[model samples]
Target: MIRKLKSGQYRIYSRKVDPKTNKRKNLGTFDTLEAAKRHEQEIQYFKHKG
Candidate 1:
């Protein structure tokens, strides 16, 4: 998922919340939504490859 921060930056997070922490994992923070989405796709590709 992608979220916009108070600073106007975009953040990428895992689709599911962590069972232990009860929070979504912070994948990355980006200056733009497009950048965050691109990183999210890379993460998905690697995750599925293994």
Candidate 2:
């Protein structure tokens, strides 16, 4: 999902409402929406790298 950070930029994170955890948690923050997309892509890349 796309989210706005305290820095006034947007970030992307794993979709919430999937596992539906009762508790709230923050995963990351980014300088821009593009940056967030890149981060998510990088994480995905590393996960499948091996």
Candidate 3:
């Protein structure tokens, strides 16, 4: 099983950041862990498609 983030979000590799940033940005807040992974996968798919 994949690791989890907040109950509302995902710890998606794409959404992870170092502790030195000046901003906070998360990919999406999902209703379920499954949904979060799906969102992450979709983003990667489209990102590689372009």
Off by over 4 Å in 2: 5-7, 15-25
* Cα RMSD to the true fold for all candidates: 0.8, 3.2, 4.2
lDDT for each residue of candidate 2 in 1-50, tens digit (9 for 90 to 100): 66887879876656544466753445577787888887878877896898
Which order, best to worst by lDDT? 1, 2, 3
TM-score against truth, every candidate: 0.91, 0.54, 0.54
Best-fitting candidate, scored by TM-score: 1
Better of 1 and 2 by lDDT: 1
Candidate 3 at residue 47, lDDT?
Answer: 79
| Superposition TM-score, candidate 1 onto the true structure | 0.91
Candidate 3 lDDT by residue in tens digits, 1-50: 23466554545444455477744455556667788778777888897995
* Tens-digit lDDT track of model 1 for 11-50: 9888999999999999899999999989989998999995
lDDT of 1: 0.93
TM-score, structure 2 vs. true: 0.54
